[model samples]
Target: MELTKEQLAFFDTFGFIKLSGLLKADITWITEEFEAVFPMLEEKHDGSKRTMIVPFADQREKLCSLVDDPRIAGIAKSLLGDDFNYMGSDGNYYTGDTGWHRDGENRARRHVKIALYLDALDGSSGALRVIPGSHRLDDKFGVDVKRVSQSQTALHVAGPDVPAVALDVVPGDVLVFDHNLFHASFGGSTHRRMFTLNLCERFGEDALDELRAYILLHAHFKREHYYGSAMLRSAGPERRVHLEQVDALCGDYAERTKDLPELPLKALI
Candidate 1:
């Protein structure tokens, strides 16, 4: 299940790669789990706006084991190194258009997201679009793309009109991209089903403080722990490697966020 050298090169050069039907065989159960998770949440999606849950896969044992799946693990190992950390997961039911934006501007360590879209989509139907090579912030091209993307009105064009590659996908396809890559979606339905696994290169001791700060961002989701009980309970040695670093820091995370006031889901959105 390892990525071919050509595939690796494509991802490194363009900032994203789509592995079509990679999860086809497992999509049935995968979709079942996805549908099942929403009901377990305290808040329900009334279709007015986006609804999201953090630590999504951790809610179901089978989904938690997705990290250990060879297809997924191999991709992470290939892109971020064998010791990459599993940062977190999020499940979503999206509403309309999403403006072009990067998930992060990480200069210290490379981070990648593996996305699973549970329904069919194309450029005209809310498929993911990315500006090629925009992930490399250090590059001049990336810098200019970021500038133009942030100010589309200057060119008299709107978001969907921006020049980019549309990555059309179906139930079993997997889309992987750099965290710093600028991406957006357009013409989507109200209930677009999707989830993502976020992973990053293992941080060194020098970057522990930065890592902790990043963890605190989870407070936006009102998350006390980065992972759920099922994920922790189901992790074997192989899976534990990805979880250990963040697990060791949870004590500090809890203490720091203990006083943060809880807000309603819609308010957070």
Candidate 2:
């Protein structure tokens, strides 16, 4: 399941790579599990805006095993390293278009996102679009793309019109990209189904604080821990390697966020 040298090079240079039908054989049960998770949550999508659930795959045992899947783990290990940490996941029902933006500006530790879309999509139907090499924040091309895309008006062009690669995909296709890469989607159905697995290089002693800060951001989802019970319970030694680091550092998350005002459920999106 490991990526080839050329695939690795493509990802390194362009910030993204698409593995068509990587999960095709398993898409049936995968989609079943995906549909089952939404009802287990407190909020539901009504086609008004986006509805998302954090630690998504963690909610179901079958979904939790996705991290243990060789195809997924291999990709993460290839891009970030064997000791990569699982940064949590989100399942979503998206409405309308998403403007260009980077998931995070993670200069210290490289992070990659593995996206699985449940429906067929293309450039005109909300496929993921990425500006190649935009993950290299240190480069001029990366800097210019970020600047212009962030403010569409500066280029006098709409988001969909921006120059980028549109990654069309159907159920089971996998899209992996660096967290710093600029990406967007346009002209999609109201209930486009998708979910993501975020993984990153394990933090060094010097970066533990930064890691803690990042873990704390999960509080916005009202999460007490990054991994749900099913996720932790299903992990064998191999999968445990990805969960342990974050689990060790998130012990006080609930105590730290206990007093924060409760947000409306919709705000969790």
Candidate 3:
């Protein structure tokens, strides 16, 4: 289940990699859990803007265990090391196009997203698109992309016209991409189902302040803990290694949010 050295190299160079049908056998259960989560929150996707539940997998035991799955853990360990931090999950019923953007503009930490798309898709049908090597900060190409893509005057084209790789996928496919990578999706149905597990390299004591800041940026989802109680209680030691770091640091979310503006209940796409 582990990625080969060459596969790792490909990711490091390209900013993403796709594993087709990697979770095919588990697709049935995964799909069921994916469907059950939204109902637990008493919210239904009405094919509107978007329906998102942060700490999505935390609502159900089966979904919580997704991060602990051997095949999934192997991918995280391969890229971010064994002591990676589990940065929570997001379940979505995606609507319309997602304009080009990176997750966190900070390029300091090694943050990666593992996306599980639950339907068939192609270049024109809401498939994920990524600009190759766009994650590199020092390269001229990356610099040009940052400059040109940011304004219509520079590129004179819309996001959908941007040059990129379209990653076509099916029910059981997994897509892992760098957080800095520029990505977007287009021409999709209103009720496209997908979920993501975010993981990143654990920070050292010297960099903990930076990590804390990153956690605060996303603290809108949690009340007191970064993860839900069900997610933590169901974890074994192996899974705890991934969840522990964020759990230890995110306890101050409520205190932090006291002075901040009110956050929307559901995350919009």
Candidate 3 per-residue C-alpha lDDT over 1-269 given as tens digits, one digit per residue, 9 for 90 to 100 = 68999999999999999999999999999999899877755446778888888778887998888888889999999999988888988889999888888776546668999999999999899999999898886688777778535646777877788889999999999999998888999898998899999999988878887877877877654365668778999999998888777777766767886764332454564
lDDT string, candidate 1, 80-121, tens digits = 889899998988999888888999999988999999999999
Instruction: Give the distance in Å from residue 12's predicted Cα in candidate 2 to where it truly belongs.
Output: 0.6
Worst lDDT run of 10 residues, candidate 3, spans 260-269
Report the lDDT of model 2 for residue 63: 93
Which candidate's TM-score is highest? 2
Better by TM-score, candidate 2 or 1: 2
Model 2 RMSD, rounded to 1 decimal: 1.6
What does the lDDT read for residue 106 in candidate 2?
Answer: 84
lDDT accuracy of residue 53 in candidate 1: 78
Model 2, 1-269: lDDT tens digits are 78999999999899999999999999999999999988765567888999887778989999989898999999988888888999888889999899999998888889999999999999999999999999999898877887646565688788888888999999989999999999999999999999999999999978888888888875565457767889988889999999999889878877877775443365344
Query: Which regions of candidate 3 fall more than 4 Å away from where they truly are?
Result: 148-151, 258-266
Per candidate, the number of residue pairs that clash is 0, 0, 0
